[model samples]
Target chain A: MLKLISSQIVSMNDIEEEILDRKNRKKSTNMILCEKVIGQILEEITLSEYDLIICTGEGELGQTYSFFSSLASKDHARPIFFQNSLHNSTLGSVSLQIPNIHLGISASNGFISYETGIEMALASSSTKPVIIVGIDAYPKELLEVKERIYGNEIKLKSGACGALFLKDSTSELFKSHKGRVLTDICFNTHCEAPTSREVFPANGLEDILRKLSQNHTNFTVNRPGGDSIVYSFES
Target chain B: MNPVDTISITGHGLISPAGIGLDALWEKCLSNNSVIKNGLGVIPKSDFSKVTQFVENSKWCKSIPKVKSKALYYSLFSIMSAIDSAKWIELNKTDTIVIGTTTGNLTSWEDSLMSYSLGDDKDQTIESIREQSLGQLSVEIKKTLAFTGKVLITSSACSASTQAITLAYQQLSSKRSVRAIVGGVEELGKLTIRGFGSLKLLTEDNCKPFDQNRTGINLSEGGAFFTLERNSDSPYLLRDGSTVLDSYHMTSPHPEGKGYQKSIHETLELSGLTKESISLIHAHGTGSFHNDQSEGFALNAIFGNQVPVISTKGVHGHALAASGAFELGIILKVLETQLIPPSSALVEQDQEIDLLLPRKPLEGKVTNILKATLGFGGVNSSFIVSRRDDA
Candidate 1:
């Protein structure tokens, strides 16, 4: 059984503040948001206790734009920007901050990226704790591009959601709290939800965390293109 | 045997700089000729255009609108080839598709960005931007194939496809899906070329891995796919695999190759195999100094000079995320032919590297082969493939 130890959600506003306040901010907005949310969750559990880290998203689009912009202008792109432009760079940052975790994965499935991360975490055979983080940050520069692409129907937000999961064991960090047992989670390509919602990579996991906070035991989150992630929980 | 160990590689397809299809790639490997021209492992324009035209004319192209990205074309062509090789007319709704990619539709994104930068928004379209999503690769595959199951995309740099294969193994082992279409695709683009160039990791000459005069990697692009299932009758069985992080550096690997060692150890432990059981070690060997050195120390510590090792980056170039899948295809050929291809572009071996590097094709009683790949940000993955008869 996989048990949710603790989870944190960071809004776009908070991520913006963190990005602005950092003096040495060479990282991408997605990396900054991931570190912020994962940092909050680490306050509850020791970093060393986690055995795996799974980062999910399309990657640092802002950095990608910057790298391309540099090239378009006949300028040498920064090596750091090139390195951080990778989707897995966010996971690399987390691994650097917390050196104990030996396994790290960066996955992306667009709006259902969070669900994909959850599925991967659940599928892992490791019995130790795992940390799954879903992050998305749309740079202001890409707003026009996004507008042309997603149109008005889909509202893409910039934020991050992080969760700590333990398999077949309860951690002392959440011993006093009543942890929600994640009974089953799977991705369905067929849409069964009543209504369609905005497409944000981190929203599905964010919605689940909100529902769990309200003491809701069972719920489902549907993605765009008739895909849905069904979540079942037990107290 | 464990159910996880039951997963087999039923079929595979390839599109590399060497050529298209598994036969072309294997022939190139055996010929020991470096396909790297002008410092890039690129698919010949003829092969590229041929596959594009074939995909456009194929029945799979009827459903979706015209795709502008070469990455999508490569992926579709490879998947169709894999399914054809598997001899499956239809796919089950419960089947899953996992793709590993370093750059997904990057060429499209580059064009859009360039146009946008020039204030020319005429070419930018919704479909083009949607295609930029790494996940969109699998979605397009699903639409063309009409499968209503789980879709995943792993974008973990160089080891992305290896991780995808490992995830498919886990999914089938856990009974989440009975069969999976697993592969990795990368397309050559300005972003990767200039990006690696800025880091001074690109070589103008041939990429010579583990060679004393090794300079840097030659970036390449291609795709390879495999049909994995629980069928025991398959010729090749995916023994097991592991992915581990170095947690040491962003671009450079641990000097001692600690992460790679751990990954190899864990894969062996889980697969119930030992060092002596592996017939060949397909090293990542990007021809980059740090990667080759790190992997060299790791392999030396683990296998000493007992296991024969080879790196084919010189022939096909480093396809980044697709390199592991390309090597896996080569490994399958190695098992079938009972011959190990020589490491291409090796003039003199690096004295510091202690492992045995093959300079010529060796015929042996091949059975289990270990394939390992290390990517940027210290992601290391290792897996074993064995002949079914041996099992």
Candidate 2:
């Protein structure tokens, strides 16, 4: 069992002003989203308390678009774009801000990225608390390419969600949130909920965090291929 | 006492720049010839075409939709080779598949994007885009293999494959899955070439890991896959592994390799082994100044010039995400042959690097081996692979 110590969701709308006014605007949207979500979580708990940080997303489509667009235009592509294009770049950027934690991992599995992050967190044998950040940004520049590929416009929005999980043994720090605990986590299981499209790859995990905050007990993330990941919580 | 449930690496397949198959790779490593040409470790065009044609001709290709991703082809070929080597008649639905990659299908994406930019959007199809998704790499393999258990794709830069292998070990150890097909694949792309080049981390000549005059790394491409099972009667057993982050820098490692030291110590402690038990250490050794210097500092601090350390990046080049699997393939060969391949292109060892850097193939009673990889995001992963005496 794992305890949900704290969580926060940051959307593009939440950071629109910062995105516009930032001096280092070269940062990818995914990086900004990660910083936002992690910043909120840090407000609740100090960075030193966390042992592991895991970031999950589909890809850095925004940065990829910029890099490829430059290539397409025969313009000199910025090296930072290529560097930020890596899926793990967001986590790397976060590492720069929080320089004390020693273990950061990035995972991606398309729409199942959030669940994958949770699974990795649960599978980790670390006795200390873990932070899982689910992040994806809308690739506005790739919308045309996406439409050409999918034969229709796909709906996507930039959003990031983070959750701080502590194992039952390590729940002393957040003993007050005993009811907000994960009783079990089942992956690749059957799903009763209908598959639906998400605004972002990590929307499912974000929705679960929201529902859990509202005192919901059970949640199911319906994967595209009829499989599901069920997260049971004690409310 | 309860019986130990060891996760053994039953079989593995390699498609490295040296050539295809384990024999070719091992022979290339022992030959002391760097496959890197003009500072790039690319698969020979002939071998690439051969494997592409082989994958296309395979019976499994009939069901899946045709895709233009070379990474997919490399992954399928390696997965099939591993399955064949493992002699698994059929895959079970409960078995899981995990793939690690840095740039998945980016070559195809580049073509699509270029075509689209040139006012020809023919290549930008849904299937093509989906095939390029990092997660879709494992999905494609799962579809080809017809497995429904669980699919995971890790894209943690250089440490990706090692993390995948560690995840598989954890799953099998926890009894969540009975078997796992785990590995990583990478294809040379302009993005990676330019990305590292932009960072000024690309070497102009042969990569010489731990050398005093080491410049940087040579970008390489390939794939390696392995079949892992619990309590298997295989010679190589994946004893345990651990991953940690430096939390220091995004592109650079902790100067003293603090994260690496933690990862190695944790892996050894979990595997119930000590540093002295490790016969050889496969250092990440990308030939970069900071990487080698930091890793050298860490290894020296831990082993103190006792264990023989070698980096094969000079031989096969840095496969990036696929490097861990590639090195693991070499480690398996080391266990079988008891001959450790020399660190290629090593002229003069850096004075600061005090560990033993073997320049010639050393034949010895090799036992347990430790493999460590450090990635772009300060992620450090270490795992131990041991030879099963009974096998």
Candidate 3:
């Protein structure tokens, strides 16, 4: 059985709580988003014992543009602000901050990023705790690009979410601590339309967490390209 | 409960510094000569700065959109050739597809930024920034091949593909998927060039792993793919794969390579093999001071001087995330020839490292091969391929 030890959510405003390096230098928005999410998740759980920290998500627009623009600068003159501007930066920073974690993998599978992280956490959790994190920020700049191009209707916000998956034996201590226990997790390529509200990459995981809180229940997280991964829980 | 633990690699496709197709690649590998050197790319850069790279320019290369991300082109060509090579003509909706990459479609990403900055706002379409997520490789390949299989893209700097191969082994081991295409693809990009340059990790000279005077790495790009299934008359069987994070640093490895040693041991255990069973060792050997030093210690602790180590960077250069998959082709060659290529750029091997690096192509009865890659952000991966006795 797999159990969620602790989880946290972070939004754009959370960056205000951080005192970043090079105070005078600009902290790329993605850096802020990643650092905030990683910082909050680490606060909720100790990663020193985690066998794997699986961070899965396609980066949000802010970080994407930051890295891209830096690459596009004239004469290669943009002094690199972020060492790793790729989507893996989230995993990179998390690893640097918590250097004792046994292993970490950064994966991007479009909308299924979080579910993939959860699955990897379960599959590799026999030996030690696995901290699975999903983070993405729809930067204001990206939204602007979308609006200018597609004329978007619904507003969007930058957000991140993460969970710590521990084996049921050790996770027994958190049975009553508002965390959820897993009875089984199933992944399928056959398309199953979830009769549920659609949520974007980083924000919608709460639906699974909430449904799993019931005494016995199952939830489906639909991924892009019409695939569904069902997660069932029995407390 | 009755499933055998072995996973077969039916076939492979590759686009390397040597050439295209598996046979073309083996020809170069057998020669023990490097096709690496400093040169400008087909696409122009203002600085016109030249660096070592393994390039392929042909009709196949031009089959894609010709965007900034050379990875797209590399992956497309390699994946198609892989599918054809495997002759598993049909990609069922259930087949697993996983790709390992450092930067996905970086050229297109940089192109998008350049256009937007230059007032070409129309260029910022959904497709333009698609690669930002680093999932673009699979998206492009799936659509191009008309394959409906599920896809996963794993990133861990240079060790990306080896990790993907390891993940495939786990999936196959668990009976999750009967068939999985697992490998890595990478391309030279602005951030990779500048990022490494900023970190002062690039060697203006040819990268020489294990050499005492080694300076740094030469950034390069390539791709290779292998189809893994339950049973086949393939040349080699993927025995096991394992990943261990050194948790040492963001840009460098642990001084002692503790994580690397853990990964090697784990991989050996999973393969149900021992250090004695491993006939050859494929070293990451990026020629960087920290990387070689850390890896040398790991090799020493695991194999000591009992086994031989080979570095392909001298021939292929460093393909970043694609390096692992790209190097797998060489391992395939070694499996067939039972002869290991010597260190292409080694000169006066480092005294600190007691590991043996064959300075010339060495022939032997190599069967079980261990290929290990250590990446940035402390990711170390190892995968072993052994000849099936029954085959």
Candidate 3 structure, TM-score to reference: 0.86
Best by the DockQ measure: 1
**Model 2: residue A137 alpha-carbon error in angstroms:** 0.8
Question: Lowest summed-lDDT stretch of 10 residues in model 2 chain A?
Answer: A146-155
Each prediction's DockQ against the real complex: 0.68, 0.56, 0.40
Candidate closer to the true structure by lDDT (higher is better), 2 or 3 = 2
lDDT values, one for every candidate: 0.81, 0.80, 0.68
Predict model 3's lDDT versus the native. 0.68
Which wins on DockQ, candidate 1 or candidate 3? 1
- Deviation from native of the Cα of residue B16 in model 2, angstroms: 0.9
Per-residue C-alpha lDDT of model 1 across residues A115-226, encoded as one tens digit per residue:
8877777777666677788887787877657656755566667777888877746546445445688978867777744343544665567778767778887776667655
Question: Model 2: how far is A80 from its true place, Å?
Answer: 1.4
Q: Candidate 2: which pairs clash?
A: A102-B245, A103-B245
After superposing candidate 3, which stretches have Cα over 4 Å from the reference? Answer: A19-48, A60-64, A67-74, A77-82, A146-154, A168-200, A213-216, A223-228, B1-3, B39-69, B123-127, B233-235
Report the lDDT tens digits of candidate 2 across residue range A1-235. 6787787888879988768966648678888878888778888777564654445545788787777778778756678888888888887777777646555678888767877776666666666777788887757656555544433324556788888878746445766554367766666644554434445666566667666767678876675434577788876
Local error of candidate 1 at residue B76 (angstroms): 1.1
Over B1-391, each residue of candidate 3 has an lDDT whose tens digit, in order, gives: 1355457887787776666566655665556555666621122232111111222232223233434355766676666567667887577766777789877777666666656755566644544755566655665666555565557778777888988887776666656567888788876766677767778888777778889999888887667888898766786888667788775566778998977899899888877799998898999999899899988998998889879988878666888888888778888878877778887678889999889889878888888989998887678888898877765
Task: Estimate candidate 1's alpha-carbon lDDT, on a 0 to 1 scale.
Answer: 0.81
| Chain B superposition TM-score per model | 0.96, 0.96, 0.90
Going through the candidates in order, state the TM-score of chain A alone for each one: 0.87, 0.84, 0.75
Residue pairs clashing, model 1? none
